[model samples]
Target chain A: MNNELRIMQNIYYDNSATTKVDPKVLKAMLPYLENEFGNSGSVHSFGQRALAAVDEARDKVANFFGSEAQEIIFTSGATESNNLAIRGVVDNAIKGGQKVHIITSKIEHPAVLEVFKYLEKNNLVETDYVEVDENGVIKLDQLEKKIKENTVLVSIMYANNEVGSVQPIESVKKILKQVQNDRGEKGLPLYFHVDAVQAVNHLDCNVDMLGADLLSLSGHKIYGPKGIGALYVRKGVKLAPIVFGGHQEYNIRTGTLNVPGIVGLGVAIELVAKEKGPSKLKEKLVAELKNISDIKFNGDLENQLPNIINISFLNAEGESILMMLDMEGIAISTGSACSSGSLEPSHVLTAMGIKPQWSHGCIRISLGRFNSEAEVEPFITALKTTIEKLRKMAP
Target chain B: MKYTKKLLEHFQSPHNQGKIKNADGVGEVGNIKCGDIMKLYLKVGKNKKGDDIIKDIKFETLGCAAAIGATSMLTDLAKGKTFDEALNISKDDIVKALGGVPPIKHHCSVLAQDALKKAIASYKTRNS
Candidate 1:
């Protein structure tokens, strides 16, 4: 262990909450914060240089998502990106004389789910929150039934944070496929967006393959700095700008630009993506977690993100297990970083139909490049022991 | 896998846990979202002389073991003490009483402290 870690016990397995910024990505960002601090949109040589840097960073992110450079809009993170996409749709439909309807899943991160709620409350839009199965995936048939002529958008998360369940984007893609066909044309399109934050690292999301016209990604989740992310709005996708200002980001988004954060996000994306092979690593953790008595694995093991394993210990409460694990030098999360401080059960778990008893017992263990099998074996062992002890004593 | 002997003792034979349902003053806090609901009942006023001693203390926490453990310890230490005395009890006392917990588990102490203070505040709310 390094001196920095030696000063404190450091078993950081909570990549799902946020990741340690990659050294390479951070190193790449030093220049932007120092001498290269010119606005990307300016006209002078300094500005031109910074502008070139922004273009290169945009290209990197666009390439990562298999999208065109112009299609990507810089945002604060997935929350802002989700807000832009969903609300943009609602606002545009209102302007165009069409009533708005939206469809989303129950197990979405608050970013996506809350925007829908705001829209529904405003009366400008009506929403249908599709239910997730026991495994935390949406029923596509139910999604199909919810899709009315007024349904202007379907917003679902690319992955479930609490359970690590990967949604059937391809299946949802097929529905969008039929939507276009049955509507008789693709013009005046209804958008389909995925908050691809958790999936951005684990699942390969080529915009074409996923067939999503809009996708939101976060920098911090993929080993970049926080307060930065990007939105992928496919070419020909239309939504009026929410924040009015100068014609930045093709007049779709406004701001001087978060140059360093953008640069870091792009670099981090390049570094964290899996080269190949995932099932083995994830399966190993699942197998070990299952050996611990009273563990209930949330989400679809086969179809979920290989890096995330959410387990509920019937023997002990989730927070207790977390506390015990932290003392043992392991770091993880009970829910989204957004809701971690709350005493309530995670909305994501409850939406998966997990009972309160188990929900309170749940914690997400997300692995990253820094983790290893050696680290994992001990982790599972420690957790199992903790759960067993707590179970025997808890009334 | 077993919890530390110290932690188990706190859970099984928790010190100072009981309820005074007909408490002179009651305090409760509920997190509607987390579903970990806590209700604290306190029988306030003096034991015999007109001292500020707490008469009885109890808590019902629908949460994990540490929650139960911490709350149990809070009540164990607070009963029969003055209201001012009970309110002074910090999470440190609970952690010390249970022989220490992991730092992440520090939140449990926070919960216990909040529930305790709220219960005391509730008692004062009525007494005043």
Candidate 2:
């Protein structure tokens, strides 16, 4: 293979986009794929075996977030979970003929943001966006004011995928509680949903600790298989089904269960739960890149996830930087992988008040558990050279 | 967008990538939405036939690979052509020269062609 083809095995720094499946997780999933291909819904010995495995996996995944297994609902991925959380609640509110209002931040992932947009466009609900600071943290006082007589849902991402800014979810939950108390006479139902896809592996995700009534997470983010994820609905939250079919998952999300994928996710979450994340390597990467001039960190380093480092190179275009790094057999992203092909700059960064030019220049380096101290220097070297070359060529 | 090997080559070492000093004509194009900016410069001279030709050309672009590649390829295609011929180099020709740009990034190539047309127009007006 040529250098371009060989570059496929380059140092991957885009783990936040997706992670390579851990070998151990694959090993654990093999038996399910090979011999135990029974449908969990079937009423046979094979079905019972599959059902037991899925149940155990659910328990493991629920334990990862300090929840009961029955509260976890398996879905395709975080996108589905986010939709189930946001739309599910909205649909229920609509059925009750409530004047529903939804609150989200300007920097939410498109999974959450687009759902709200769809709801708003169709006149299903009125949506208000809480403003985020430069660090991408939602302003609590501003959020408090956005709460109105009919506010039904508040969906905020636990961590931004572009900038890795960890939102103060705990404080956000407290604010929601206070607002609920202030509106107790009217008894307007308010639910707090957290898109924790980016936070599950790098942060404390205990649902009670974060005070999240609904949380969405994907298995692939934690080095598990793709196409499998889980959503946590706190008991008695009264969520409606967005996808209805065979009445699986408490009739909330219904599809034939993915047996092997669930097995892989179970093992993957267990493994990540035991492993220390890429914090040291991240620190090393930041320190090495510090030598490059005109480079600015885009998010809060102290309160952010340990693995993701978002930076903007002044006078350099992000797509150019991305291509140059690819040429050097290094991998990174200009923004969310979902919108990499889009011409617009990152909505998350732009929402954080970054200038359009600077947002176009932003690049995210999201390390993974596989990254080591040894790769840090080489990555820094590649980044420095790429930025220098792009800046030199800049008008 | 997946760039062809040839496109990547030109993008890595774009030709005529610096601004020209006191040029005969200058054209600038920017996509406020995409945040891509390109400035094209032309140094026009007369051939033996006394028709205006581009004697030298340079560009300064702050954009994606396709934008830079289109400008680089545009400069190469327009360098020896008369002002009218340079104007005839369409966005498709530049896209073809780069092998292809992603459909979403075709605007980058279009921006390049626009910049060249504007440059030639600027030259004609200045000399007219």
Candidate 3:
């Protein structure tokens, strides 16, 4: 027991929030941050070197998404990528004096949902949210029904970070194709966007397979450095740049390139794309956790990412469980890291109609490459005992 | 939210937990938005000065660590004190007792203090 305590000093299981930068990714990024400092936009030899590196990174990233190099645009992170994709399309459509409407799922991350809300708030666009089942899968018929003559875009996530529910992107794409064909006679175009921040590392992200006209991804979610992400815009897609500045990223996004972050993101994507994730370890942990009474698992386990699992200890408070787990050096989260400090229940869970009490008690355990397969047994032991203790304290 | 070590201690093993059976006073406060609900139970008795004193205090709280810690500290701070003195135990006193709670969770300390006051008010009405 003492030996187990000694080794259990830093078992991180919160990969969905972010990942520790892979050492190989860090090794690749070091030169850019130190000596290889040059603006990709400049004309000097040093600048040419940086520009070449940037081009290489773009190609790698683009290849991971099954996109052409020119189609990928670098941004600050998934938040910025999401913002640029949604707002760019809507703002452009509105400028063309087209009545703009958007369709999104209720379980979308705030990065997507909040942008729609902002556009809707200003009367720039009309929006509708598609409902999800108890497992957090978007209802395809309901989504198709929400499409209107003026519906310019349908933005949905590739997978949910909190519950690990992988959306049926191909099905959504088929529905969009039908909608587009129906609207073709009227000369209307409906674009499909996906927030693939959580899905890029764990799932097949081929844009062709997913049928995404635009997609968003973050570096940190896949073991890259923070502050770097990309947006994939299919060639010939019209999108108004959100941030107006020096001509960069095909005039869709403008800023000095985050060279080190970009380089790290490329290597991280390459490394994680090959990883299948530790589902065996996850299943082992879940089976052990089920021994505790009244524990409910969230998301569609049959069709979801292997690394992320969310569960609710019926009578326990999520924050209390988080803190207790922290004390034992088992890091986890109650919901998205963006909304973890807030008191409100996760919007995703509520949208799926999970009971309020269960939602409040929900915590996500996301594994990653660094997590040892041997740690699963100890994690199970700690979680089982911790839930028992917290449940006993419950009123 | 970062909790002080003392607060963590209190939250893990609250000084006064469970319900006071046939309690003289019971107070419940629910933060609907945060989904935190605190129920405080109190038993009052006469002190040497013939003043109403808190004879027993217990709590059943469904909240974060700070909420549980603050309520636990409130019980410890108010026990054996006169009704007026217990009522005087402010949110600051609870915060100070547990080292401190984060700015976002200051309302937890406030919730604890408010629950105690409500319990005392209930006691006053019952005895009156």
- Flag the better candidate by lDDT, 1 or 3: 3
* Arranged by DockQ, best first: 2, 3, 1
Highest DockQ: give the candidate number: 2
Model 2 residue A173 CA deviation in Å: 1.5
lDDT of 3 by residue, B51-113 (tens): 889999999887778888888999999999998888888888888888877877888888888
lDDT of 3 by residue, A1-395 (tens): 24355544589999999999999999999999889999988999888889988998999999998889999999999999999999999888888577788999999988999998998898889999999999999999899788888888999999998899999999999998998887775566789999998888778899999999999999998899999999999997889999999999988999889888988988998897777655587887777777878878998788788888899877778888888778788999985211256766888888888887787678999988788878887777777777777666556
Cα lDDT for residue A363, candidate 1: 85
Residues A320-356, model 2: lDDT tens digits:
8888888787889886221366666788887888887
DockQ, candidate no. 3: 0.50
Q: On a 0 to 1 TM-score scale, where does candidate 1 land against the true structure? A: 0.79
The per-residue C-alpha lDDT of model 3 at residue B22 equals 99
Query: Candidate 2 — which residues are off by over 4 angstroms?
Result: A1-9, A183-186, A336-342, B19-22, B121-128
- Backbone clash pairs for candidate 2 read none
**lDDT tens per residue, model 1, A231-340:** 99999878778898988888888988999998898788878554455636667877777777767888877777888888877636676667667766899877522125
List DockQ, one per candidate, in order. Answer: 0.19, 0.60, 0.50
Q: Could you give candidate 1's per-residue lDDT for residues B1-128 as a string of tens digits?
A: 23355675565555555556577776666444454556677776676768877777777665555667778788888878887778788889878887886565567667777877887777678778
Question: What's the count of clashing pairs in each model shown?
Answer: 8, 0, 0
The reply for model 1, stretches above 4 Å from the true place, is A1-8, A335-343, B1-66, B78-128
The residue pairs that clash in candidate 3, if any, are none
- Candidate 1 CAPRI level: incorrect
